[model samples]
Target: MSGDHSTYAPRSGFTKWIDTRLPLPRLMHDSFVSYPVPRNLNYAYTFGGILSIMLGLQMLTGIVLAMHYVASTDQAFTSVEFIMRDVNYGWLLRYLHANGASFFFLAVYLHIARGLYYGSYKAPRELLWILGVVILFLMMGTAFMGYVLPWGQMSFWGATVITGFFSAFPAVGDWIQRLLIGGFAVGQPTLNRFYSLHYLLPFMIAGVVILHIWALHVTGQTNPTGVDIRKKTDTIPFTPYATIKDALGMSVFFLVFAYFVFYMPNYLGHADNYIEANSLKTPAEIVPEWYFLPFYAMLRAITFNLGPINSKLGGVLTMFASILVLFVVPWLDTSKVRSAVYRPVYKVCFWLFIVDCLLLGWCGSQPPQGAIVLTAQLGTLYYFGFFLIIMPLLGLVEKPRRLPNSITEAVLSRRQTSAGRPAGATAAPEDRG
Candidate 1:
């Protein structure tokens, strides 16, 4: 039974109290009622929700771990050990934080890929995708710095190698390097700064993600079918529909996460990090985490160091640019069609881009040997070309096949006709190869 609006007036007591303090109704309306989200937003859209939940997990587990962590280089390694040995349920926090980073990235990359596939970055949704890019950069920076806080060998050298990328800029290269390291090298001062920054960046990511959500909310979500939402008939309330999809998606994602936690938690970790940090000694193969490897490979691809230009700053700039180039993807992609399925030329380039990234990642882990250097050069060229050259070209030259008139038609046509199931109705994903 519903209350009679004619007999009701504005609340004066507990309703007012809750409205002023929590504003639950307003939040519910904004999130579920007023928002007109697409009906066909498949599994990909759930990644953004999963990412939001994982960020909360990271913050909680990180805070608890930080309580046991010593920022000092002298005790940082021992503190990790002490947590393992002394603190109650410390391993849970540590495992959660470490694997949580991987899961966060997993969700983000999927979210971005979803955007890429759906043309979610075009026009009104451009700012949302851009915000996601910025959030990505923040996540990378946060992860890089956080890896160093453990005061392990891989942590130290990985920090050195990655921070060294900043020197790619002219003039202030050395100064930036010293500032980052807090001296000429990674030591106690570097550990302290990294610790402080690592703690601070998650909050920064949260702030950016708020902007990301706002941007996404303004334009709503993109679906796999690249259909547009124009009227109430074309859309559904964001709640029960999108919420259920998000819930299911998170459940699947957590299954993958649980597998990592239970079976291969340390599979993502480096062995050298088991050792304590030492300024005097360095690991023979001090590679950054797998996520940073592609960019790292890009930096090493450039062999000639030009004085201070060739210093740590140059390395830093090259590395940062590797991902920074991503922010401009919407501009680079010239095709009018948003879906990769529609663009034959674009789809092939997409796979090449994936290959280039994997090759670059592989080469980054190798020493700067003769063959590896050559391979890195090829991969680097392809990497830049994928975005800078191919994407722009595909936009101009490629002809997009006819697209569906609307999202509803696209979703309906897939089901069937009264005549019977047409060819490819309820079809499996074609092997685009």
Candidate 2:
């Protein structure tokens, strides 16, 4: 599939000259126009395109907002208010930038979920999956910094709380914390540092995104069937086929984004954030954004020390390990089978894992007391166990359903079954599940 890029041809003399000089048009034609993707790819595959669009939208809005934004701690909150009330369409830009971050995370979570469901992290794509995790880490850092730019109550406290986590490390912890905040605490220097990094990280993300896409095109996309393409019939040209689906998916996604932007701009934001930062008077409970909730829950889950490890350090390690675990996921699952579709046992476990994540998110938002703390501990256990225990064990003990020989057969056999024909009749007995 990676070798199939010879179909592009310049139509005119001027175009031909440019093609010989740079060949960027040829590269685009090969990558997007004629690239062959699985014929049976569902809407789940569209999130990649949606993410690209969201990234572009975020950068554009951010650049505009930065023009009016004040990085100073004293004027940061006032500058945001100025953008919302005084500048032309500044409110729209702010809403788009703010809400766009949420939707961007939503799309990325779904994209990662889809990857897990379809085994997009399997062998020959391990680097692709690792690069994706790298992108997620970069996004998290970018979002955390961006969250501080508002310089609201939550923004100030959130930065202080999160950055303080680094102090859990032995000897070097305090230094790391100081380096992150640019001083002893979350004050003027911290605000300046975060604002500059927040502005710069998105472009860094864009660069990594290029490498991610390059890796993806090199390995090709995984389909729902978990079967590789073996014939021309297994795939279709990307232009009209995949492009139309991506466009439709993005259209629906944009409508939801627009709704949040226009009608419920503050729905996803904290009311306390509307108030300016007050170091003297702290909010009752400082919560990070919703996207950070699950990890926050994990961070809080470690209430007790394990031998020499203190609670603070344990929680910090656990929180960091949760994300780091994903970097090794391509090697964690022992199964040769890609898709959960065939692995009924893993399929059940997968949904349970997702529930555990949502449970953790809920736990993070609430006061960490009584049942919530206990539940979060249990959820965190299951979260790691799903990767550390279940994934490795299930692959050896469970029996997966029969898989079709190739993508073409899977598509044809599904259609045949929907038409009331016996599944076994469409394929040889050995290939029938």
Candidate 3:
């Protein structure tokens, strides 16, 4: 697929000269305009395009926010207030940027879940998956840094708490923590550094996104049936077809985003953030943004010590390991079948895993006491076990149902069944081994 060159022809002498030099237009045409996509892809496939739009929106809004944003400890919170009240349309920009983060995460989570459901991370696309995980990590860092820019109560304490996580390391933990904050605590230096990094990481994410797309084009997209595209009938050009669908999906997404931005701008933010940072006082309950809650729950779930490892360090490691484990998922799930659609047993386990994650997120949001703590511990265990144990074991023991011969076959069979017509003969049996 990577070798599939653009068939674009220059229409003018100037265009021909540029095409010979850069071929930039040609690359765009090949990647998006004339790209061949599986005809059977569902709405889930549209999230990728939606996410791209969100990233662009974020970068554009963030740049404008930074123009008026004061990153100093003394003026940061007031600057945000100024943006809301004094600056022209600054309230709109700030709200859009803030809420855009949530929308971006929402789209990305769905995109990742879609990938997991269809085995988009399997062989020949492992690097594509890894690049995606890299983008995720970068996004988390950028968001965390951006959150600290407000320098409000939660912003200050959240920074203090999260940066202190580095102190969980055995010997050099303290040193690392000090380095991160640039002082003894979350102060002017910390705010300055976060501001600088917040500005930098998104562009880095964009760079990696380019690589992710390149890798995607190389391997081509995986379909619902988990079968490779073998014929022209299995795919369609991306222009008009896929592009139109993506445009519609993006329009619907922006409608929801606009509602939140206009009517419920502060809906996703903490009320405590309205108050300025107070080094002397801390909120009774410190919580992260909703998106980070699941991993945060995992971090707080470690209440007991194991051997030489203390609970603090263990929790930190567990929280990070949860994300790190995704890097090796392609190898961990031994099943040759990519999509869960044909893998009944795997489908059940997949939903259970999703539930476990939600439980952990809920646990993270609540106080870690009594039932919540126990549930979080259980959920965390299951989260790891799903990837480490169940995925591998299921691949070896469970039988996947028959897969369609091609993407076209899967689409037609579904259509035939929906129309109350008999589907064509099934393909030959696939090797279980």
Instruction: Provide the TM-score for each candidate, comma-separated.
Output: 0.89, 0.96, 0.96
How accurate locally is residue 399 in candidate 2, as Cα lDDT from 0 to 100? Answer: 97
- Over the stretch 1-433, how does candidate 2's per-residue lDDT look in tens digits? 2345568889999999998898888888888989988999999999999999999999999999999999998899999999999999999999999999999999999999999999999999999999899999999999999999999999999999999999999999999999999888899999998888988889999998999999988888999989887889988999999999999999999999999999999999899999999999889999999999999999999999999999999999999999999999988889989999999999999999999999999999999999999999999999999999998889899899999999989988888778756645778777765
Residue 243 C-alpha lDDT in model 1: 81
Error of 3 at 308 (Å): 0.7
RMSD to native for every prediction? 5.4, 4.0, 5.0
Shift of residue 309 alpha carbon in model 2, Å: 0.6
lDDT of 3 by residue, 210-266 (tens): 999999988888988889999989989889888999999999999999999999999
Candidate 2 lDDT at 54 equals 97
Scored by lDDT, the top model is 2
| Cα lDDT, all candidates | 0.80, 0.93, 0.92
- Quote the lDDT for 31 in model 2: 88
- For candidate 1, the 10 contiguous residues with the lowest summed lDDT are 1-10
Off by over 4 Å in 1: 1-13, 16-24, 304-316, 417-419, 422-433
